[model samples]
Target: MKRVALLVLPALLLAGCAAKEAEPASAGLTVTGRYPLEYAEQFTIDECAGGYSLVTIGEERYLVVPEDAPLPTGLEQDLTILQQPIENIYLVSTSVMDPIISIGALDSIALSGTQADGWYLRQAREAMENGEIAYAGRYSTPDYETILNADCGLAIENTMIYHTPEVKEQLERFGIPVLVERSSYEENPLARMEWVKLYGLLLGKKEQAEQQFAEAEQRIAPLADQPSTGKTVAFFSITSNGLATVRKGNDYVARMIEMAGGDYVFADLTDNGNNLATVNLSLENFYAGAKDADVLIYNSTIEGEVDSLAALLEKCPLLADCKAVQQGNVWCTAQSLFQQSMELPDLILDMNRVFTQENPPESELKFLTKIQ
Candidate 1:
């Protein structure tokens, strides 16, 4: 793969700011080595002379500079620089919380964009209740006063931050680096989980992150050798307007279903490799595409789970005509399914079990529950 990087010129970066606009690595920069990677392709961690770690994510780049280390001279002035052992992070990206937590660096986060009650993770909720992590406001409306008071080192945001670019500008105006984590944009399910390695490096937990990712990789290794279950799955949930929100064929949901040895019934409904992972289908269209699917997995991460078959039918009466519905092969995802970003293998295993077994053990079901 082609290597693209940026320069982090300490001479040009404003004081207290960890990031700046990205520019290509100019004269006087040298590549040393890169942190080993497995499945993650969205970002890269490269080393330069004098121990400067250049992290490239798409067109943007960030350099992790060691404490008290003198800046590298002659590099481009546009790339951002983050001091090592970042602290007091104002995290607005909910998926990032899992990776940060997986490395035991939850203490490093000083503020959350999600409210106390908004978190599905117990550690996050407890952290907020115990005053360890406070709500600093949402991504669009951050509490600048609180963030400044906390001396926040970084502001981690999701793609939604793009909708409020002015807020990003304001954070930079205050010399606070705003990083938009794009793990959710990954097409591969494990690739999204692989971002844990990147967060591990940011929090100075490289070894732990590597171990976590390796273990997860090993756990799912056998899945590749498993024969296809010859079953088809339809993963979707009804939207507020009575439409079905479903994963596109190229989406991670479809990828996960395939890895679990099942076929995605809507595998041809791709978004032409765009960033969008899901597409909305009218009830009639969804039924036409998925009526004969052997399994129906209700994606409850967004709309909340239905407790029973009757509840699901009440929400979408058309499902009653589906083959999976008639055969009692319907299941609903747990509410925590999306929030458990670090548990990719476990989730894949859950899906695999559902496809291969007539009655998967209830005690072992982690991300899904069969509708009774």
Candidate 2:
């Protein structure tokens, strides 16, 4: 039987429409409207007549109150109230920190789930060095005292936090609300970047957030009409055991490649019901499928960058026979590309340049470096 594709409403296309008042919610307050998003599917913001916004992330709901706004009467006993002007936060999600920095709310963060050395954002690294943001331990083992002493208003964590429910429970037990950022779950690169709006809303920088998202949308405007470059590309990482880990056909990385006017070589790959975007296979199996690919892009976000065609061949000696390697058509992505959500469009443009051989000044290419 053929499968039916799911129809996901463009949370992006709905932006700027007049917000209509909806039915009265729990406290007899009607939802007046909401900040419309473009591609994001992981969360929503509904404005209420009582001057509060209801934020829903996954299955968790939060009531956001603007500074000096009165709390609505008779809210659900279990609902969390996130008063605005929030300060002293603990951020664990590395990708989330970029958007937080983009929204200019870095000062509000007092604790970090990632160590200073683990950060790729210069501002975050500098802040940690200056004692503005202290180490609060990783998600699996958070420092309770650091969080408590910092008076953490909220805990922004990644999906990995779910693996340690006790840590989340302990933070909540201490009155620190934990919000799991879900941008990584989005399958569309733009949808993932659209999370900037979510951060903007939370930090009271809605205008800046809107502008940031708009600018990124504009960056990919050419993609909406550009024809496919007809190039076949394979992107993967070599694991420690010599297995090749490649993205699923419908994964966001594959989608990004398609948007860049190229066809993903492994367009039919899937691991049934695993919910994993990537799957590992023997190097021989990978070679059988992609040996003739026109371009090979190494994902350095996982195993780090590899220099020289000879060095890559050392990792997978079989790849030395692949068409791309033989033709010297290989590239490597920057280690920080995955964490900086705003740069995915730029990455697409970089791929386009390689596929089309648009030799702009070398300085124009940001994320990808040629493998000599």
Candidate 3:
């Protein structure tokens, strides 16, 4: 269960290969193929949800015409294929935004689920002001009129959208194709990064998508050789009610800590047969288990901001006695890190820097900062 173990698949390994040259055949032969998607496990190309591996380029099926958009040339009457060069998209998943940005496909996004003020990425903010990206309401309660007005060709949703099947159905009924993204389910951090390539294919920026993954892998490659420091770290947040919620052992955050040369204190805390990736504990139990951890990383995304060590202690004075607090090893991640999937490499490097004492005690960090 080492992060290094999942790094074996090189970034280029998932690049869709060119269609094989077809041999000369009888005059009446008609050839077709499906697009190949090598790495992503969440969804398949051209294959039924259960039966087959990815299909190559020419064989794609399940074509749906957008509302008022004309069908592309040469499409089979009953076959399904998205009209190429997807120009207008409604992005419901904030995490998927970074991947779309990485491939230079931001211009293609016409609608977003996040409000302008909630956007942390400057590009997303600017797009909103420029009138290029419009608010289309959240996934739970989308504005159907705005979506139809945008002439949305596609809507990329996260798994959470499943809770609102009526919303998804409504979009489809309006001629927008809805694709549910499951990248968060990937246990391996690198595999999660591989999902960028899938977005690249959809955005028609496959080359840039492959390049982004390649660069991310190159940045993480050296960490595989770093010696393990055997330090133990705890990553969690205290809820408003004082309940402690921690990531399951196999979650990407835990794997990232292990890759950065620290041992996750709760590495055995996962529910074996269930798909839950986090568990809640009483404050008393949290104090007992994490009191001796060498480092403690606050999950700011869920707990809101903890500006200082004093502030954290004020929230739960018992934490003042934890080893991490006593040794000044407490840190907090930025809220944006939770939605910025493309920053995984930087996140791992930040963890390694803290775990190995490679930087000054008060140095500013990219994704995390020392709790003052």
Which candidate number would show the highest TM-score if scored against the true structure? 1
In terms of lDDT, the poorest run of 10 residues in model 2 is: 1-10
Which residue window of length 10 is worst by lDDT in model 1?
1-10
TM-score of 3: 0.81
Query: For residues 1-372, what per-residue lDDT tens digits would candidate 1 score against the true structure?
Result: 111122335453323122233333434445556666677788888766566677878777787776667656655566776776688999999988888888899998999999999899999999999999999999999999998888888898888888999998898778788778888777798899899988887788988988888888888889999999999999999988899999888888899999999999999998765577788899999999999999999999889888999988888898899999999999998888787898878889999999999999989988889998
Model 3 C-alpha lDDT per residue in residues 1-372, reported as the tens digit of each score: 000000111111212222233321112211233445444555444322112123222222233223234433433333323554566788988988988998999988899999888888889989998899999999999999988777787787887787888987787666676767777777778878888877776666779999998898889889998888888999999898988989889888899999999999988898767666788889888888899999999999887879999899877788999998998888898888867888898889888889887444445468888887
| Candidates ranked by lDDT | 1, 2, 3
Better of 1 and 2 by TM-score: 1
Candidate achieving higher lDDT, 1 or 3: 1
TM-score against native, each model = 0.92, 0.91, 0.81
Candidate that would win on lDDT: 1
Q: Can you tell me which runs of candidate 1 are displaced by over 4 Å?
A: 1-29, 272-274
Q: Compute the lDDT for candidate 3.
A: 0.73
